[model samples]
Each structure stands twice: as structure tokens, then as C-alpha cells.
Target: MFHVALTGLLTGLALIVAVGAQNAFLLRQGIRGEQVLPIVLTCLLSDVVAITAGVAGLGIVLERWPSVLPVAQVLGGLYLIAFGIHAAMRAWKPTALTTEGGASLTVGKAIVLTLALTWLNPHFYLDAVLMLGTVANSFGEDRWWFLSGTLLASLLWFFGLGYGARLLRGLFARPSAWRVLDSGIAVLMGVLGVGLLAH
Candidate 1:
């Protein structure tokens, strides 16, 4: 059981460590110190639901649906591309800093954006649901333990990312720093989208 859980935790972390739109967004939110808790919680909960679905056989079921994959892939790719363009525009357009707190982006927007960023990507299903589920299934009776470990990993990662950026808020206060960050996010999203389309 211990070995199974360890394997699952490591596997989950390994899958998540890759730079993606979701991670980029979380880091930005952290740096801005805006809607941090809600964003983190939404991401964590979404992962829990996704991973649970995988463990419950939804992954395999989805895999069997070939038509659905391509559609999801296209939608996800397009969404990423759109988001990348938006970020790029923000980077290109310099904005004046306001002392009356940062511009109100709203928690609702953050949650929606986070969900779209995380869930819209079909790669998420491939990694979090399909791949993880397949591996967990290999454990037979110990699969539940493996799922628990994976969940723990997800929780730790989201919380760390969401709160960790707050530590850098001071650095991000500079307009130039925000431009760089936004530019990086734009590039990442575009690259990921292109990669998805190619695959």
C-alpha cells in the first residue's frame, strides 16, 4: 500500500510539473496577490474531480470515444490560442499603475478562467484521467490508496503554487515585471496550443 501510494504521488507530481496555462495563471495570480484562495481552491477541486473520474473508469470510457477526443482537442487548442492572444495584447499594451489597489478582475472571472484553462485542454484528460487511471488500475485492490496519494499531490501542488507567488508580489509591482510575466504566459499558451494542434 505504501509503495502504491508513493508511486501514485510521484506520478501525479511528475505529470503536473510541466509548465502549462493553468500553472502560468496560478503563478501570475500569486504574483498579483489577487483571488489567490479561490483560484487555488477551484484548481484543487477540479483536479480532485478529474482524478476521481479517472479512478472510476471514466478515463477508459472517454478513451474509447475516438470522435470526442478530436473535438475536445480542437476546442482546447482554440481556447488556448485565444487566451494567448489576449495575454499577448495585454503585454503589448502598457498600463499605468494605480495606487487604488489593482484593477478589479473579480474572483468569479478567476475561477472561470482557471477552470477553462485547466479543463479545456484535452491533454489534461490524457494525463490526469487516462494515464493516471490506467496506472492506478494496475494496483488492483490498492487502487484507492494510489488515488489518495495522487489527490494529496494535487492538493499540495495547487496550494503551493497559489500561495507561493504571493511571496513575489513586491517584485511584480513593477509594470515591466508584469509585461514580462504576461509575455511569458502568452508564449507558453501559444506553444502549448500549437503542440496540441500538431498532435
Candidate 2:
């Protein structure tokens, strides 16, 4: 069981450690010191629901309706493109960081954006649902242990990301740093969005 759990933890980290749309958004919010709690919880809960659903055989259902993923991909791709454009605009018009928490978003808005970024990404389903689900189910009766391990991975990551980002506040204090970060985010989103569409 411990071995199985360890496998789960490593797998989860491998899938999530990339600089994806979700991470980009969270990093921005964390640095700005805005609505971090709700965003982190939303991400963690989304992972729990997705991973559990996958282990409970959502993958089988998806296989039955093969069109589901493609449809999601198309929609998610378009959404990502639009979001990428928005990020690019931010990069073009960079803002200096302020101690007053400049241009902060409301908690409700932050949660909504977090949900959209999480759910509207086709890769989320691929990684969290189908891939993780298939792997967990392979653990047979110990799948729950695997599931627990994955959950722990998510818990550690989100809390660490959300809170740990605060450590970079000083670095992001410069306007140029903000521009560079937003530019990277834009490029990441655009590439991911196009990849989904072209896939």
C-alpha cells in the first residue's frame, strides 16, 4: 500500500508540476496577495472530484461516448485562446506592483476564474481523470490508497503554490518582472490552446 501510494504521489506531481494555465493564474493571484484561499480550495476540490470520478469509472463512460473529449477539447481550446489573448494584453500593458494590492479581483471572481481555468482545460480531464483514474484502478483494492496519495499531492501543491508564491513578492515588485511573467503566461496559454485545437 505504501508503495502504491508513493507511486500515486510521484505520478501526481509529474503531471502537475508544469507551468500550465492553472499554475499561471494561481501564481499571479498569489503574488498579488488576493483571494488565495478560495482559489487554492477550488483547485484542490476540483482535483478530488475529478480523480475520484475517474477511479469510479468515468473513464469507461468517456470511452463509451468517444465524442465527449473532442467536444471538450474544441470548447476548451477556444476558451484558452481567448484567455491567452487577454494575458497577452496584460503583458503588453504591464503594471507596476503596488503594496496596496493593485487591481485585485473579488473573491467570487477569483473562484470563478479558477474554476474556469481548471474545468475548461481538456488536459485536466486527460491527466486527472483518464490517466490517473486508469492508474488508480490498476491498483485494484489498493486504489483507495493510491487515491489518498494523489489527494495528498494536490493538497501539498496548492497550499505550497498559493502560499509559497508570496515569497516572490519582492521579485515581482518591478514592472518589468510583471511583463515577463505575463508574456510567458500568454505564450503558454496560446501554445496549449492551439495544441488542443490541432490535436
Candidate number with greatest lDDT: 2
Q: Which candidate ranks first by TM-score, i.e. highest? A: 2
lDDT of 2: 0.88
Stretches off by above 4 angstroms in model 1 are 96-103
Q: Please give the range of 10 consecutive residues that has the lowest summed lDDT in model 1.
A: 95-104
Per-model CA lDDT versus the true structure: 0.85, 0.88
- Per-residue C-alpha lDDT of model 1 across residues 71-126, encoded as one tens digit per residue: 87888898999999988887777662311234556989999999999889998888
TM-score of each: 0.93, 0.95
lDDT of 1: 0.85
Which ranges of candidate 2 are over 4 A from the true structure? Answer: 96-102
| Candidate 2: residue 166 lDDT (0-100) | 93
